[model samples]
Target: MDPELLTIVVMNVMNTTRLVLHYFMSCETENDSVVPALLAAMETNNSRLLLAFTEQLHAVDRRYWARETSTEWWDRIVMHVWDDEQWLQNFRMRKSTFLELCAELAPALRRKDTRMRAALTVEKRVAIAVWKLATPDCYRSVAKQFGVGKSTVGAVVMQVCRAINRLLLRRTVTLGNVQEIIDGFEAMGFPNCGGAIDGTHIPILAPDHLAREYINRKGYFSMVLQALVDHRGRFTDINAGRSGKVHDAHIFQNTGLYRKLHSGTFFPDQKIPMGDVEMPIVILGDPAYPLLPWLMKPYTGKLDSSKERFNNRLSRCRMTVERAFGRLKGRWRCLFGRLDLDEENIPMVIAACCILHNICEVKGEKFPQEWSAEVERLAADFEQPDTRAIRGAQCVAIRIREALKEHFDHDSQ
Candidate 1:
């Protein structure tokens, strides 16, 4: 037995003995008829306390006596044997990129070694988290592969995910070089376009509270991940944790992105002349989003050749966001299956995945062809939400869409 644990047990026993002695002395001065009842009550209380203490000591003893698990798989196979390709296959990032992330997250995830056990190394902790996110394995499977306790795997995942969100999310998933994004979109035939926005459902275990709210139109429990991506299919901003039943427009309107765009603060003042109207920078969305001066969704109802051409162009550009999401879930296969984490922690994990996606993309990591097929299959499973266009469209927004249609028409000629 550990000296500290032995000392603690001895102290508890002494305190209980002293307490019993005091009770007996007090009961001696009480009525003779009441003495038996008092002793009975004290005996019951002491038995309960002793049972609880005995259980706790057994638990501590089991923990102390358990031999440390061998980490041969992680120590030898992963550390010494794997190459860059293997790392990318398993972790979805190259060894160099993984090291960079470990360094970035070290401050938050690093733990001190205790008397009983050595703390997990920073690299190992990060690897455990990334593997959990990148693959569909449950905690038990992950623990077995990594040679750690199942609970340790879960704790390490949350710790690393929270660290990634706290340290990297804002910096990695932001709109960078706005003019460059606009230029990229213009080259793709959408003038003055800043980004493409869309939403997808991330499947999750049904939460205990308000479980029905998470069921989407498709009849599965999920949370909405609304994302805005630049021309290169990199996420610029993401809004997650919204109930799956919510509309895309509703989620969009509630985001800080909406506020920034509405207040004319999201984009730069750059504009291009389309006949008499000066077109402000805009983001392209599908018909699910409302048409605004800053947001251009496709025209609904019957359309002529010119309007059709505009919608086609917009759809092509908006595919950036869709493909971004496809790649996101494709790389992080855990997102394809229902996440088994607590509802509160799911958002952090999602954000961490996005941050990692950006890193992999920016680093020019090659996405495997096999993952693309999985993404397509995942896409086919979900039905599109019913489009509910907001009523009372602004005249300026109408003019902007019309002007863009005419521009496409003239450009085709």
Candidate 2:
């Protein structure tokens, strides 16, 4: 075997062992309101039982892999249970309701003999277990964090995503805030602006030989996350596909969002006509997108026409999408780097964040001050130009500036 290959194998084995050990013996820290409730279901002397289970983990490791490592490894595991006693006491969720819900969904959820079975009572325990996995760490890390086996960590993630996806099936569009988002754009100098359209890169390690295909000029392998925002910087549509190597135009053509303007009924038995009535759904783009009639790009040429003025203001409004992506990836530094999962799981997790972001925005929830500040700070970096990657990047930049010559270009009319 190649020396590099041998090194990787050895490193993987060492990391695996450390993560598994971490799972068993990590000391607890503070829990948010949710973690405590998750811990509440444990019976008396649960810690003592947990410690004994850690001991049994050694036996299971020996029997399964015949690689007798260390019981001392178990001593290294950490738990955060002591951080919030009040939270545990006050946490409320009907254990019966959860069990009944679980019974309806998957009866095999908590077989006492199963490794994934909860040490605590609240159904939120399972949900929390699922949540700890938002980071793309190995199951060993997640297992270590949640005090369960690696296999259990994997199962919890899959189950939670599928379960949540199904339960949240009736997600209506957030057009309720559409007017507010549009209002934000109007204030920012873009009127009647529907949303900003842009793409983001999510880093993930290469999975196989074809992994090279996913790598981009950014010096990392990534998947492009494309989003369409409403006038107020609220997300209206998101599609995660196409590796970083694919151009923005290719992604736009494939997305099929334009079809919505052409098809579908509005109310009972009222069939909408199919004639090409150009109801303008402004998809504000930089020159990276095509100059189609419906989708507007910034103007780069001399400001002589109504189109030039329109592009100018359109560019300014569309900027919010770029800033939003900057805020999201910069605040979540984990997203700025590589993810651990295969490509398939990557999209699911990315989709979950997009969904959660809209949900949180709708709920008016905010992250800590530090993250908020980071978002504002790193935002300028996103607007910086790349002269090399895009041949017409400079010309497009010119077009955007020209397009912004006036707000809405009504002077031409």
Candidate 3:
């Protein structure tokens, strides 16, 4: 044989012999007495012995593969367990609400013409969508548990999400009931307060392009979800998908709410009577937002006793938005972790979640126990002021805050 071929034969025999020896040594009854002869044979470079051993080892370690089992259990779980309240706790919604949601989404999510094999039903698809939001599992793990492919899970989630956004978002997330909002605020000791405004960062995977633009001051890639929440912890309006690096003020200015408020068409022009002073009915926010005639923020710098009282009242009321956010994120744990999706799709998903949150609130569903910690964490991540307000806006904001301070002080006396 050629010298190269001979060397190869010797190496193969040695490897085979090592494997057999190791396997035998692993057996509790096997003895170590055959080691001396095996070592001597390997030192002699026995090509013949190696050639014989190679054929024996080939069949010994033959690989076998099994096909993946179909995920028929997903249907069983949805139709069966999803209807049982005791077992339905896993789905994060009451059985009645789940069925109602399914019925509402059935028309939009119905698929009679699809060619995909073993296509998921609208009910299952909606369940999968809500399941993704309610749990921290990745697509693969969720798919495996649901007995579907990962791609299918992702597709179902997006399909149901878009359907929810299209069918329920506008109808459910409207600020049309301004009187209710005003009343709700008044009940919270903030008379004339229309809504509590605030911005939160929803963590996302940085885009391949404009990655830096998505990074906020906190050193994470996120998208800003600026919301106007009612006193009942429901989101009345939301403007999401802004670059995280932008300031809360900039994000607010870009929203339709800002445009409408600036144009003097969004809210009524009538002034709210506070003692002798007349102040505009406005939304409340932190100092990170601009202090418009229709928006209020707490005192930024030095404070005397009255200013301190004003800040405390504003903070106490402003915390409504924080609590709303906490409940939102707590109920939907998907928001707790970074979303591994394209940036464009994120806002729709968020909107869908907000819509569902409102539905739950209307239906009187409580936040899950698992979500309390996340809600508390989200409540703590308040936005700091990003820019110095223009001098005129600053002066106007100060006067409004001072007026409110007097109102609160007078009420205490």
Best-performing candidate as measured by TM-score? 1
Per-residue alpha-carbon lDDT of candidate 3 for residues 1-413, written as tens digits (9 for 90 to 100): 34456558667767887887677556665555666566566556555665655655654643554437555666565566545554345566787888899999999888774664555677778878898988878999888877777888899999988999889988898777787888878877777887888888888887889899988887778888899988787888899899888888888988998898778677777677765567777899887776776788776667787777777777777898888877788778788688887888999888888898899888888665657765666545533224444323656656766678888888878
What is the clash count for each candidate, in the order shown?
0, 24, 0
Weakest 10 consecutive residues of candidate 2 by summed lDDT: 265-274
Candidate 3 pairs with clashing backbones:
none
**Candidate 1: stretches off by over 4 Å:** 1-68, 380-387
Model 1 lDDT per residue over 36-153, tens place: 6666776677677667667666666454456457799998898889999999999998889999989999999888999977899999999999999999898989998888999999
lDDT of 2 by residue, 286-343 (tens): 7677654345566555656666556556767787887667545532344644666667
TM-score of each: 0.84, 0.58, 0.78
On the 0 to 100 scale, the lDDT of residue 299 in model 1 is: 81
lDDT of 3 at 48: 61
RMSD of each: 8.2, 19.4, 13.6
Task: Give the C-alpha miss distance for residue 346 in model 3, angstroms.
Answer: 1.2
lDDT of 1: 0.88
**Model 2 scores what on Cα lDDT?**
0.52
Better of 1 and 3 by TM-score: 1
TM-score for candidate 1: 0.84
